[model samples]
Target chain A: MTRATKPMSLTVNDRQVGPVAVPEGLMMQDFLHEYLNLTGARMGCGQGICHACTVVVEEEDGTLAEMRTCIVGAHWFEGRRVRTIEGIAERDTDGAVTDLSPVQQAFIEHFSFQCGYCTPGFVIGATVLLDRLQREPVSREDLEEVITEALDKHICRCTGYIRYLEAVRDVALKTPGLVTS
Target chain B: MKKRFVVFYTAGVVLIFMFAAAVAVFFGAFQSSVVGSEVEEPLLPDERKALAERGAYVATAADCYACHTAPGGAPWAGGLPIETPFGIIYATNISPDKEHGIGEWTRAEFHRAMRDGVGKHGAPLYPAMPYVSYRKMTPEDVDAVYAYLMSREPMPVADKTNELTFPFNMRRLLRFWNLLNLPGDTFQARDDRSEQWNRGHYVVDALGHCGECHTPRNVMMGMKESAYLQGAVLEGMEAPDVTREGLLRMGFDAPSLAHFMQRGVSAQGGMTGDMFEVVHFSTQYMRQEDLDAMAAYLFDVDDIAAAEEPPPQPEPVEVSAEIAASARGTYLNLCSGCHGASGEGIPHVAVPMTTNITLRLEDPRNFLQTVLHGIPELDFPGVERMQPMPDFADKLDDQELADLATWMRARWGGQGSDVSPSDVENLRREAHD
Candidate 1:
């Protein structure tokens, strides 16, 4: 059975991108890099085994979710607001990139990345994660689950998992509503 | 046209100033070699005499503290969690605890254990203990570490069982592990090399156990004999490829490599992640001659071709705030002394709640237990002084203690599992009952 190809429209990194034409079932990883120059989202594991291609997808419900962009198909992002690591913290209140955001700043301060290959995806995925947690304060189990969910797919081989966990935890405490029950 | 020209002239001046300022900011961001150049720490005449006397350099070179004592454990009391593929294995008490520890072991037994991987009862130890690497230790160095431990205060805590899976926990199976492993031997000076190079090799390979993390592991997680120093993963951390071979792939030239070791950032590459820990523990402590030797050895060696590129890698997780939702109340209730409002705190006196070594140790159980129960007061002879880290077991219940420990670990990006209330209850019982 053949699925018909679909055309999609979306804003990526603030540019009103397209009502572009695309394959019916191309994986999101190929859709982003092959069709769009969104090189910030990488293809670490095509199968979503590694969360290299995570992107922030604004839902129709005015909510944001980090979709691996690799496992999801091209049509899934239709009419969605998709943000890559490049777009996480566009600018500070003062307008120049708020050095991209506290989360990015904390990542730098903590020496969180090693090869830097995975950093963009991690940053994007985390921003979306923190947003969700603020909507509902995370429970202890929720904390573990949320962390596992956000980072579960991202495979970091350096500094182990401690620094990353600490980075998010630090941001959470500062985040108020999200950290405290 | 005059107005436009005037604007252009003024803007040109402004742009020049801006350029100069930008250059300053950009250059300022790069680490400089400049320092006040305090007089280098001099070993006193007596200290020099002590070092020259016999085993002085060995203890210093071996850097026993990097492994055995760095965890703020009862100085030299061991019990730090050592990770292996098999499971989490706690370092045994090297303090003079006779039954539960090494208090009554004979010198010969210690020697055999260090050099031969044979214990006092003739049991072969797992290589995770680094006996394979320690075997290269000259007798003098072994004597120094031994002397240091013997002189330490006796800590009476019993050994914790290794949480290894079945075949690994079976002591007899380790014999097979050892058989496949090349027997460790004493370091022999290479006649072709300079004394410093040999010294560097001996230090990096033997006492330092640099290979334990750098050397790729076999299926069992034992250091792959063929790929020694190629770099591997440990306790969820990536051991940077220290070998010239692996370093080349990462684009580290010799001078830059030496600089990276002496200072923490690569001359060109970024200084991020566990490499900082390596800099803190070993490389930063090195003298120039040793650093040169290490650079030489690494650059001189060849890398066995491994994977085409770094394996499909993942970025560090962006943890959600929900993870800390459970931890926030506990931090407010039990923490906030050393850890501040945002969880940042004064180093040494109080740990920063976020992104610190103390918070991300191999095991927070000890850290939690110590914080709750307090550290054993120590005032060792011939040692510099430090304040005792207080314990909290007295005031907090298991749930509260668990919550605090879990909160602290989660709060500051500590990379560990949350301690269950049962774990806290068990530890509380073990400590007091």
Candidate 2:
């Protein structure tokens, strides 16, 4: 059977990536791995039940939400802005690693991940949570619940999830204006 | 003075007559419909085995275990709280424990309870027990079920107290309810109908008790006989009309309906909401022939006399440009990824929006609720499965959700775009409650 193809383009990591031909129903996970050669986002379960393959998508109104890459097709992200794990860290003029993002640093400091397969998804989730909190800060009392609501979906097999929770909580507390009185 | 005396006398007489009539009705409802002895002779090993096996089948068809067993609790040691309009009624333990469960209850008592909604101690049971539907079960079936219950492992769990409100808290009030709602006769085979049809009727009405949820109830909370299987909304979910005309209109034939019953998902759509429990616990375990019979009865195929044909699809209508433009992007970004760009639906992932009956519903409560709180990943019989639909409750605001629903309904559901932002808000609030 002849495969159907569609032309699409999207902004990835602040770069104009494609206006090229892609299979009609190719998943975003495959496109990230095979087409763009970006392997930071690890595919887990592939059914969207496990949110381990999520990437950040910026809405038209400049709000952020995580979309599962394994289940969503690449064409669905047409003309959209997205951020993967590889794009999270700071880069210098020579394109060398400058500094780790606060979420990444927190994860390392707290020993949040063991296998690191699920770390990318957790980082994305935490980043989105932090971004959301920036706009609408939570009270210290409701901080834990709010954090759980955001990062609860991302599964980590090796870590018991306590460290990850603590890491995210530490970032939320340390980052002023993210958690209010 | 003489005229006043005459009026007072007349009023007193009328009051007495009314009281007498009420007493007669109460006695009439309480009268035992089934006559049988609880005493039984000891059965041989072979006979006991056969009886137990038959009992198991009847119990499954009746779906006794689903209600009797609480989540993560011992089987038949009931603590499941059933929600009704009145209040929550916790299911009674039905294990073989003598003190707490129904171990000492006679077969005659079980028969009376099943047929009349009366407990072994002659107390009236709440209608949440579905005795109104179980009253239609044949004596043999009831006996088989009783045997099956006796065979279950007893867990010495005590019954939970019901938490009904005001006048409904009084069990004596149900005598009047029974007077209006209770049917006297057991299942009767229609001579004009085929055996399969009769069997199907028994399963649907008596054992399966589908009407408890599907059939609309009158003000008295009794199933309305005139509008049987017309569907009703309970706990914010609309059970769609399953009448012959309604089924056909929604694109269902016997084969597909039977297939859906046997294995939760079909080309039409997979079961969601309360129906998932029915499939997970009841219909999935039923025999294929019974499933076929149920489909045949629901579609009323015998009267058609024509060859079985697929139901015709609805003609596509154009959605308003404004709705299309507003919600199309949201749908593409969030939903279209799994549901398909054209709403064709990904096989084993999401159902095709075009034929999904939820959108075709007159009451958009179920549709709106599903969208606000997305469905969890579900497993159907065999290899059939669907991934969890991400909830848009936190992501999309009320207006966005309403627009998306309206767009979906108009574009593919053949429904009008009448879902206002307020409708989404109200349903979202109600879902939380």
Q: TM-score of chain B, per candidate?
A: 0.54, 0.93
Give one digit per residue, the lDDT tens place, for model 1 in B1-433: 9999999999999999988855553333221211112213333445434544344335545555555653666765666777655688777767767876677776566776777676768666767678778888776566556655665578767667779888777665555556556453457888886665676687678866778778887886667878878666554345656665556544456666677676653223223334555565656666777777677666663221221232121122333455454454445323442345466544433434443434444355545656665543232222322234435565456766666666565545334466778877766666563
User: Model 1, chain A: how large is the TM-score?
Assistant: 0.83
Best by lDDT: 2
Clash totals for all models, in order?
19, 0
Q: What is the TM-score of each candidate against the true structure?
A: 0.45, 0.85
Worst 10 residues of 2 chain A by lDDT: A1-10
Per-model root-mean-square deviation over C-alphas: 28.5, 4.5
lDDT of 1 by residue, A1-181 (tens): 1345667788887778778887665666677788886688887745444677788887767677777665466665667788877677767555466555778888887888888778877787778788888787886546756776777657775644667777877787777788655
lDDT tens readout by residue for model 2, B1-433: 9999999999999999899877765555446455455423434446545677788988888888788899898899999999887889999899878998998887778887888888888878888899988888877777777777788888889989998899999787788888778876667889888777777788889988989888999999999989899999888888889988777766777777878887889777889877887888889999988887787777775432332776666665576777666677567656766777677888877888878877776677887888778888888888988877877787678888788888877766677646889998888888778
lDDT of 2: 0.82
Angstrom error at residue B286, model 2: 0.8
